[model samples]
Target: MSHLVSNAATDKISPTLPLTTDQKRLVDQILAFTTAHVNETGPAVFTVYGDAGTGKSVILAHLFNQLQTASRTRPDSPLAKTTNYFLVNHPEILKVYREIAGKEPHLLKKDFQRPTSLINQLAKGITTADVLVIDEAHLLLSQPDHYNNFYGENQLSSLLAAAKVIILVFDETQVLRMKSFWTEKRLEHLLAHYPHQHVRLTHQFRMQASDELVAWINDFTHSQVRPLPQSVGAQYDLRIFNDAEQMRRAIVTKNNQVGLSRVVSTSGYPSTLDGGKHYITEGHFHLPWDQYNYTSTPWAELPQTIDEVGSIYTCQGFDLNYVGLILGPPLTLSPQNQLEVHLDRYTDVEAFKRRADITDAQELTAIKKQLILNSVNVLMKRGVKGLYIYAHDAHLRQYLGAKAH
Candidate 1:
């Protein structure tokens, strides 16, 4: 069941070691640009755009390492004595970054912060940063969110005003919330006015699957349901299972054999913040949704997570050896045989909050559906070696099973 998925921490952000050749080139290019433009009068932005697993964060990690190295130890370097900070919105990913920083010689835990924290500090005149790097910039809030203590009109705009230079990673298809909703067109419009440079990373660096299989995944997430590829996985371990219980057993076996394998699900089952376990049950397969991991280790790295069903929030931007993915109640095969999202059946209410900028009823509904599908994209792309799926809709399962065999 194993493919050529590297066990080395390449896809995962590496603070101490640089990744592949492409990543190294990007790091060098971006660092050179940052060095030359750090003294510019106006804000400058360098954007890295790519789908999940295109080494976006990998290059950023290396870029930050170089920045810190030059600014701290090398007085002759252009970036010397410059203040820089890295920001990420996801708490889980932020935790991983901080953990990695603590182990690296040139980086410190204080160098990383949640986007909100940095913004608040800068606003208070408590901190000044010359260069800022943001991971998951797509998750930056476009509207004021009082709950997270962000009172700014837009996180990205505010950050641009506060810093002299900015570098960010953005994937529009990975946006899963209304508050952080973005499109390539919207992003382009915002950057048109700023001094911005962009590079679109087109190659797949994470999933060991073929280009045909990757295209199929993209089609499915775009609501185009077609027959499963003639080959289920070929070199990869992609497969469709009729029963969730069977898939769970297979994933557990994979985890026991390889490590870093788990069962994850798309929105459908109960999700809450009440400090309790809400189980996702399919036939005889029943497991609690991922609990809040308070420890320093990431959720997928924890030994106990194999017994829990992972959500997008827990699995995004992380690699897995194998993934047993449950396509929950919200996803189904339509009469036209197209993949569809049933918003009414989706259980994640927090992702459906109203956005003031989106007023058209039809437009809002369409955006919400895309957000739901965005979570699916994040979950399916996690497995480095394989992806095992079970659909709740009987017709969808049967349709996929027809081709899986």
Candidate 2:
């Protein structure tokens, strides 16, 4: 496959953050493999597997910059024959990358494309770089391209066919929708055909919370009950609010004092609740979920958006100073004192598009419930400094409050 020269030209070849030691080692290994692939005309696949906040994106960005520089400075080197591009599924993240390009005009030639756009281009015979780096690849469809309306069995197959070097940053637990979800077996099936290397990242860099707090979060979200460490709660600024109104006020105070804090929640209420004006309400607590069309707007960045709220979709790939998460109807505590997920109560219908095909209602319900729990896990871990939560369910709220104290 020839390198997509246009994408390489359009890529903003700069590293935004420094890679940690483990990240640096992975990049070095990838580059070394890519160099060999370029020389021998063979194919290679690389996977960076990690949970949220492992710095996977930072490593990819840094590697892209290094490759771009080598291709320019050493025209006769193996890197010269290879071109690269960055692909993201989220429009908000694409907007952020474009804004970064604006600051560094030289990166304007580097391409940052949405998966659907790139797939369409490829279908039309437009090659997009020999080296394709995909971030948030867990969102890629494992089944046929039904959502994109393309002529392909799946994205992974098409990507392998189009690129000489394919780098996928995947977090299986982050899968938000059923249509695009991939299992480990599916991922392994794809890797079986290519020479591949897998690297797993474990460090948590996004949140400033202690290790014990992080562990508690993981356990709670996974349905593994564990007592919250008193020291951990004291160290981190975690608060459970019975009243969503008070939580909102606290978020505002944090925003005014520190900055980069906002309210986010599960789509338990209708997406167009209150005509999409005031979608969230409970005893004087009124807030709206993120606007559906703000995909192009960096909702989390703009200073004027303090009043606006976001859901898992909008704030998934970004970090924040403080996060006020509304644990709406989708999450609750069962009479047995166990965490329960009410999939039917969740309002994110678009994500549950394949529900009609589920023959086994029990299994389908379990999957839906897990997806909701995964969304909550993602939201809770977004804050770099603190996580403030307001559960709509009284029992769940009380339970969380007890844990916090």
Candidate 3:
């Protein structure tokens, strides 16, 4: 396959790959559960919970592939003649799955769809769902969003009503918007009403970074700051650059040597819904945010995408050889070298839209900060081989550079 057809990011989650031991066990359990409850009156749910880079996507991909194969090709199998669909909220990831469908015999492009599309289809009575496998279920809209044309109160709730079996992956930390806000407690309560089983995959499968380095990134996302782990420099190419220009240069070099490397950032720069470019500028470093991808190919896979800066929307659920992260203006270091979120500086207004459920000022503000940190968490885990950093705040950049020994 050509580089555009497959690369590190797409290959990591390819459906054709063999599953790991844990993944295989989970798949077996889900399949057994479906066999036992597919004909039951209530929906049978097999939820998979894992943080980013824990191989949730690939496992689901493999599981769905098996389901489709059994349903379409196996004559004597109990799952034969069953209908199944693979759903994901992320458009970029949906593109990858659709592309992969073209190369596989049992997988069909029509089998992959966005959650909103499926929900609307079921509501319109155009098609009925049987088994639905949803990836990144945390991104599902819990509120009625007419902007995306979803009029349902909760997406998963509708899927449960429509499908006999539902399988999904969830990561509370990956929740980005108010419309899709979810907590562990919320998920547990929802699952309580259905016949459900869950498994949590804690293994680190994406980043080549050391355990200490991974823990450090996790702590940072939780708004905790600590001295950099000594294993960073030697164990991974975790570098903190004083200049965004230099970091961009490093990322470009890595991209030339190994494709899938790009510069990404948090949401603190100038951005709007206008169709024009919104450039992110920092001392001699300037690049526009990733444009709306209209083509079937993913943005990160496009050859010219190296010139653009990726945001959480485009780069989530992706893998890179190296990622040069420009810490946007919303993030800064305090007097004690701790990270702080400057909500006033955040430009992504869509992420902080008013929610009828939230009224307390302090609670709303805290959630906004968590959303900012969650974006950072998504970017930090993208790189498979290395992670490069540059902060817009001078003091924050200096502190990161000094601690990145």
Candidate 4:
């Protein structure tokens, strides 16, 4: 919950800078769409989709702040008195809201039997609000049956009913877990209910111009966006180290040169292999936010910067000058002898039982090829400058070799 600015340069970039051309275009479109709906006095929804690290969250944050500011300036404006809820993955936003409001926002306690009712009450308090911006919209649109049976009768229905204008920010390409709520079909369905406006964020300024990670992601997503070919001198700087020791040595050496860089594994925890170390986790490795209690061996406290043990999940909303990715398991070979992997497609029953190891025969059998394709698409598309892939599995190596060579 602590906010630390790693570098001074980041601080210079305020949260509400003048919108870039892309941002301006999206905002103008959104405003026009919302105005039309508001004129009709009907509810309207706007869905924004982009690949991870494409600055969807940043855009949303900017939009939210802009709308709130506009509302304050014109109390009688149709968009005045807007209600905004920035739902955090672990209710972290609750604290943030409390800080922003300068008062204690309602905190859902363990005994709160009907959380939805609480949300409804909160919505009622801001009934006059003109807009409600929801960041992490993917979480709400998840399947009703996934995870602790928390989703019921469409999670966004209550919020939708209360708000005149709703803005949802999310990326369809980053669903790492099978919580039923995070499916493409579900997203499509949710937006189908309303005459929603859809915007796709395409430009990625996070990484250097030479980086093709975004292009690779777009290709993986079956998007029209193409990676810069090697002919364009746009090669990803990814390399596979021989082993963990070699990787460690390289990191140590690189740290001296760059002051400090991050070493991330696709796995959440460290794993031991014959020739390398693996870290596997239920979530993606890179994330913009830091994980609580994550630490490295011989270091009592976890590194403050996410650049230390960067995972895709934690590093999704973040960017770096260089990214080193350590690929993890659930690897296999396709009929065409291509690399096939389905990281989140484990067997339903075993995953329900919370099995630590993904070794159940049923789980492996249920693995979906599409999920494997999606995983590879997400994993390979994370670098800005270079990609260093160390494939311990020979089958995977062969498949990658076919593609890279």
| TM-scores for every predicted model | 0.95, 0.89, 0.96, 0.67
RMSD of 2: 5.9
lDDT of 1 by residue, 1-405 (tens): 123433333336785554667777788888877877898875889999999978788788888988998889999987889889999998778878888787778898999999999999999999988999999899999888899999988899999888889999999999999888888888788878877888999888678787788888888999888777866445688888877888898998888888889999998899897899999999899999997788877888888888999999888888888999999999988777878789999988889878888999999999999999899999989988889999999989988862332
Candidate 3 structure lDDT = 0.86
Clashes of each: 0, 9, 0, 31
**Stretches of model 2 off by over 4 angstroms after superposition:** 1-14, 39-42, 144-151, 233-235, 272-278, 293-296, 355-360, 402-405
lDDT measured at residue 292 in model 2 versus the true structure, 0 to 100: 53
Model 3, runs deviating above 4 Å: 1-8, 233-235, 402-405
- The alpha-carbon lDDT assigned to residue 59 of candidate 3 equals 88
Q: Give candidate 4 misplaced runs (Cα > 4 Å).
A: 1-14, 35-41, 88-130, 144-151, 183-185, 209-213, 217-236, 249-260, 267-312, 333-336, 342-376, 398-405
Residue 335 Cα positional deviation in candidate 2, in Å, after optimal superposition: 2.6
Poorest 10 consecutive residues by lDDT, candidate 3: 1-10
Full-model lDDT for every candidate? 0.85, 0.74, 0.86, 0.48
